[model samples]
Target: MSRLFRDVEGGPLCPQGSVVCIGAFDGLHLGHRALVRHAVARAQALGVPAVAVSFEPLPREFFGKAAPPPRLTLPRAKVEGLLALGVDHVGLLRFNARLAAISAEQFVREVLIARLQACEVWVGPEFRFGKGRAGDIATLQALGVELGYTADEIAPVLLDSERVSSTRIRAALSAGDFANAARLLGRPYAIGGHVIHGQHLGRTLGFPTANLRFGGKVPALSGIYATRVHGVGARAWPSVSSFGTRPTVDGVEPLLEAHLFDFDGDLYGRRIEVEFVAKLRDEEKFPDLPTLVAQMHRDATEARRLLMNEQQRATA
Candidate 1:
C-alpha cells in the first residue's frame, strides 16, 4: 500500500531515503508517467522508496481561482493514478499563500531534504516550482550536489510525432477526439466520484441519473457524451452523460449526470467511474421541459447505438 502525506511539516514520509518525482501531475499523461517510472526505476536500483510529490489546487488554480484552467483529473484520481504507477509514497502538498511564498532554496531544504530525505529526484523537461517559479532542473541539480542527492529531467513522451502533455490531452477532449486523448493518456479519460443526491429532475423527465459533483474545479470537458459506468456489476454499464450546470434549471454548480441504460438500482452514495467513449454534443439549454425531454430521448438513442458499436469493436 502506498503511504500518503498532505503537508511538508509532517514527519519524514520516507526516512531512509527516497527517489522522488515532483510535478503538478494534473492528468498523469504519458510524459508524466515516463518521469515517474524513471524515479521508480532509480529507487529500485538504489534500494530506496519511490516518492511522488504533487500539489493540490495546483499552483495555477490557487493563483487563478476566479478563472482557473480546466482540470484533467481531480485530487482523488491523481492519488489513485500515482499509487497505480508503483510509487511507495505520495505527497499532495497544499498549495497556499505560505507555500507559494517559499523560495526555491527553502523548498529544497525543508520539503525535499528534511521531510522526504530524497536521495535522487526526477522531473519533466518543463517542470518548474518555487516562488516566482524560479526552480528548474538546474536549480534542483545545484541543490542536489550540496544536499547529497542527484537530479535529472526526463524527455517528454511523444505520440504520433507530438509530445504528450496535459494541454494536448485537454485540446483533444475539447475537440471531441477521444481516441487521440486516450493515446496521450495511455488509457481512457474518466471521472470518478461518489454519486450524490440531486433534485430528481431526470427521473421526472423519464431518465433517472446518477449525479457526481465536480467539487468546484473547472472540468476539462463539458458536453453530452457516450460513456460507460464501472464498479457496479460484472461488466461496465452503457450510459449517456451530461456534464454542466443546468442552465435550463437555473443551476449554479457543475454536475455530471449519468443515465445508465436499462439500470434500475439506487446509485446514490455509490462510487463509480464514468469513462468517456465519445462526445455526442455540446451542452445546451432547451426552451422548455418538453423540448429537453425530446432532446434527451434522441441523445439516449444515439448513445446506445454508439456504445453498442464500441462494444462490438472491442470484442472483435
Candidate 2:
C-alpha cells in the first residue's frame, strides 16, 4: 500500500499486474513526464497500477568516481515529481554494489516480472540498465517475449528540433538560462525541501534566512538568485535565495538559504518550494563581515526589484 519504495529485492509490489516505466528521472522534465504519463494511461486502461522504476545514487553517479557529477534533482524530489505525474507507485531502487552486479536479465526477471508483474513496460529512447549499462530497448523487447510482458520505447521529446533532455537542462542551468530550462522542464525551476537550522549567520548579518540542505548531493547550479517562495501563504512570497556553500563563513555543506521579503514567520520543519526567476550573481567570498553584509543588502535590493517586475508583468 505504500506509494514509495527504495529497494529492488522486496516482495511483489504490484501483484495484480502493472504498467511499468523505467528511467533515471532525475529532473522529471518533459521527456520523463511523457514516459510516466503514457505508462499511467496504459495502466488505467489495463486496470492496473502504474509503477515508475528509477535508481537512487543513479548508475552514472555510482560509477563516476572521478567526479560524481551534479544532480538537478535529489531522491525525494524525484519521487514526488513522478507521483505528481500520476504514477501510482514509485520505485527508487537503491543502486549499490549488489544491485549493480545483477545482469539485465536478472533485473527484468526480479524487478519487472516478479516484483511488479508488469504486463506492459515503457521507457524513453536509448534507455539502458543492468551491469556495466548493457541493457537496451532491444534487450527489453527480447526479454519481454520470454517474460510474458510487452516493452516499448517512447519517442524522445524534442524542442526546437533538439532532444529535450536532462543534459540540456543542466547546460541551460549552468549558463543561467532559466527561461530555456523552464521551457524544457515544462515548469519554473524550483527546489522544495523542509527548512533546517543553519549557523544563523544570516540573522546575525541582519538578513535572516530559512535554510534547506542538499543532502550531500552536488547541485547543478549555485549562486544568488531572485526567487519566489511557495507554500507559506496564498501566493508565492518574493525572496532572494543562495544555493551554495557559504565560503565566506567557512561553511562546508551545500545549503539553500532564502530570505523572504517583508515576511516574519517560523519556517523550520516546514516544506517550501523556491522558484528561481533570475540569477543575480555567483556566490563569492567577501573580505570581511561588513563587506559581506553590504553585498547582501545590494543583492536583496536587486532581488526585490526583479520579483516586483515579475509580479507586475504576471498581473498585467
Candidate 3:
C-alpha cells in the first residue's frame, strides 16, 4: 500500500536512515521520475522504505505571484501517479512562509536528519531549496558527509533532444501538443475534477456536457480537445472537451467541460478524469450561437474518430 503523508512544517515524519528524494515534483514528468527511480533503487539496495517528499502550494506558487503559470498536475493526481510508479510513500509538505524561512542547514539537520533520518538522498541537477533558495547539490553533498548519509544528483531526462521538464510539458500543453507532452510524461496529460452544474447551454445545443470545476491550479491549455473520460474505468469514454474562460457565455473563470459520447445520467459531484488525446482547435469567439454549435459538432466528430483509432491501436 502506498502511504500519503502531509508535512505541515519543515520537518519530516519517517525515521532516520530512510532513502528519500525531495523536490516540488509538480508534474512528476520524466525527469522527476528518473530522480525518483534512483531514490527507490537506492532504498531497495539499502533495505529501507522509499519515500518522495514534495511541497504544497509549491514555493514558486507562493513566492512568484507575478509569474504564476498554470500547473501541469494537481497534488491528488500527482500522488496517484506516484503510487502507480511503485512509490511506497509520498509526503506533501505545506510550504508556508515560516517553512520557507528555514535555512538549508536547518532543513538538512532538523528535517532530513532528525525527522526523516534519510540515509541517502536523491535530487535533480538543478534542484535548489532552503531559505531564499540557498541550497544546491554541492551544499547537500557536504552536509551528507557530516550528517552520515549520501547524496546524488540525477541528470535530466530528455525527449526529442530537449530536457524533459515541467516547464516544457506546460508549454506543450499550452500549444495543444499532447503527443509531445505525453512522450515527456510517459502518460497522457490529464485534468481531474468534480462534475459541477453549469448554465446548461450545451444541452440547448444538443450536447449535455459534464462541467468540471477543478480544485487546484488549472493547466495552461485552453481549447477544444479530443479526450478520454475515465470514471469507473471499465473503458475510457470518448469525449470532446473545452477548456477555457467561456468567453461566449461571459464566464470569467476557466472551466473544463467534457461531453462524453453516448453517456447519460446525472454526474453532478462525481469525480471525472479527462485525458487529452489530441487538440482539435483553438478556442475563439464565435459571431453567433449557431456558429459555435456548428464548430462543436465538427469537434465532436473529430474527437470520436480519433478516440476510436486510438483504442484500436491500443488493442493491437
For each candidate in the order shown, give its overall lDDT on alpha carbons. 0.92, 0.91, 0.84
lDDT of 3 by residue, 1-316 (tens): 5788776444555663688898878778888888888888888888888888888888888887777768877888788877776678888878888889999998888767877788988898688989989999888999999889888888777787878888888888888888888888888888887889999999999999989765546567889999989993588788999998887778777889999998878888989899899998888888889998998999999989988898899889
TM-score of each: 0.98, 0.98, 0.91
Clashes of each: 0, 0, 2
User: How are the candidates ranked when ordered by lDDT, highest leading?
Assistant: 1, 2, 3
Model 1, span 136-222: residue lDDT tens: 999999999998999989887888887888999999999999999999999999999999999999999999999999888999999
Lowest lDDT sum, 10 consecutive residues, model 1, at 7-16
Error of 3 at 4 (Å): 2.8
For lDDT, the strongest prediction is 1
How does candidate 1 score on lDDT? Answer: 0.92
**Candidate 2 on 182-265: residue-level lDDT in tens?**
999999989889999988889888989989988788889999999999989998999999999889889898899999999988
Instruction: Show model 1 residue runs off by greater than 4 Å.
Output: none
Candidate order by decreasing TM-score = 1, 2, 3
